[model samples]
Target: MTETPTATKEKPAHRSGLAAATREFVLIVVGALIVSSILRAFVGQMFIIPSESMQNTLLVGDRVVVEKLTDVERGDVVVFEDPGGWLGQEESGQKRGSVGRFFEVVGLLPDSSHGHLIKRLIGMPGDKVACCDAKGRLMVNGKPLDETSYLYPGDAPSAMDFQVTVPAGHVFVMGDHRSESGDSRVHLSDTGPNGGSPGDAAFVPLDKVTGRAILVVWPANRFDKLEIPDTFKDVPAAAAPPPDKPSISLTPPPK
Candidate 1:
């Protein structure tokens, strides 16, 4: 009897299309991750507070979101690149390192070669800003402000005095922690203890404004939209060459 023909079995063929689909899926995921990283690096970023210079408003260890949009108005909190040095930081480390400096050149870094700074917009180009009239209030274009809503409990409006007209294309900035912060007031060449060189007092260019800090996204309890203070409401639009009158000063009370 002839043996029955051996049954033959064929294995399923490998599909090339299936492999291509898998590869495409992997590429898409990788591309997305890269895009997100690039946005974080150049567009908007997050930062953690490393000092108390900003105090109650921005506590140490609090994370904050910084936008790269660069549009700002008065009374906005902002993040900008740091200059060559800041209070007590090592001179070398204070300068924008490779990553931050590189971004600055391309306009991704708003604070120049420095690193980054967060502060409030007080005086804009063509606006006059001064510290304390007889009542111990910051005056912007002859308008006294009511900052009780945001000022830390018991904190003075400003321990120091300053007076200056913001230059065209520049802004005057200050920290919410007036007594603790070394802001434009301390840097005015005419107002400092020595009357030598202004401390950190320098105008920030409008183009350098990165973006207004709209919300506090971290530290769950502090999360809220930063509002424009009513104090700045009556302040006049900054004008070039304030009308020949002294706007602010830092002189101590005579004994």
Candidate 2:
């Protein structure tokens, strides 16, 4: 031991501090990633407006926060999975390669390119929805919807005429820009896989709805909370059909 002690090699204080700082930084990043993932998966998610379907209300390039736990109600704007190839050849602005998709899933990027559609819930299951009831207002279960508050200025409630009873377990949806939107009304006659009838493919299944859009988060100037217009407030519950009538057909004859 008295002999010359072997030279002790110790890490410099600065080096040790650098290592600790690097580890802390990495941990913080990972923790943030986990929290974001949880929020995006269970609580809420961000979506980008890909088309002009919901003009004035939701313009293309607008970013919105979709609340997953909220109930989907009539007049609520919602994002949903495309039902039965309804979004034919529609390109998602955020469509990316594998690596890009991974980032989107991890909540690192905006979910603008996903294969989903956005629209206002117009009719609940079992509601008879019809277009242009004399005053050009949409009628649901005999009650007219005064859509002027949300309908794009100068745009009619619908350009084409249609009347269909929303089947159970599904919803009838339409965009604010009815003229430009390819919504439930457009697909009323498209037969689904089961091939039941013309109106069978028009409704979006309840399960397909992702979430209700609660806020617009992008384009700072456009920041605002989406609210249910007063028009939806006055809609009375659908009237029950008489027992003697096996079926209820509220659709008026086409001109």
Candidate 3:
């Protein structure tokens, strides 16, 4: 009634195959989890707007989807690092606990120097930006911008005046809600030496740009894809040579 030697040898081979299959299954599950974590960390991050800096365009409590593409152009809404001078000097967020903040500085968690700021790119590197011409409109490279589409009704383009040439590899940004926004113009007179003189404003480094805000993905009613504005439609590319005509300079910032 005992089995032959051939049958007994085959039993061990069957068990070996089963063990190999089980090992493969476990590895697949682990690999999937790791990939997902990385994607959440860098590819696309969800954020809630905590302030009214971009009201009408983006409201408080609205969640947005930010992509990691860095080739953003003018009139595009973008999220960037707060530059510490703007955000608190120390990390004080839920994600950046005392221990986590320490690690973030040493490359443990994400860099805490990175902060969340959303605004529109008005002027790119090496471009001349001025505000309030004869008709009270913002101008770039002698071309007036019609911000009627995005500018909040009843609000002027900007109450505080600014005129500056964005540094090489930097950008000039502003908020849709001009009156409430404390953007590049707000820091023109910062105590720092690099804050720039009365008429000029500090520039935002290109490396600080995190990503472009491509959509308002939360709150079904507010969901929509963001598009580049026509205001920059007639405006020439950054590489184009400056026009021969003179571009007016708005009132300089306070001394």
Which digits, one per residue and each the tens of the lDDT, describe model 3 over residues 139-170?
Answer: 87677899988887788987867676666667
Positional deviation of residue 232's Cα in model 1 after best superposition, in angstroms:
1.7
Q: Name the runs in model 1 displaced over 4 angstroms.
A: 1-22, 41-43, 90-114, 190-201, 241-255
Rank candidates, lDDT, best first. Answer: 2, 3, 1
RMSD, every candidate, angstroms: 7.1, 3.4, 6.6
Q: Which pairs clash in the backbone of model 3? A: none
Q: CA lDDT of each candidate? A: 0.64, 0.80, 0.69
The candidate maximizing lDDT is 2
| lDDT of each residue in 1-255, candidate 2, tens digit only | 489879999999999999999999999999998998998888888888998889989999999999898788889999998887677554345587888777778788778647799999998876777876777778877778888889999998887777776777788899999887888888776776577656556788889898999999999999999988888888776565322111223355243
Clashes of each: 13, 1, 0
| Tens digit of per-residue lDDT, candidate 1, span 1-255 | 899999897654566667788899999877766776677656776665555666677776566767666567788777655432334452112445788755544434333313466778887776877767788887777878888777766778788666667766667788887776666665564322323244323665566566666667767988877768887777787555633222334563222
Best by TM-score: 2
Write the candidate numbers in order of decreasing TM-score. 2, 3, 1
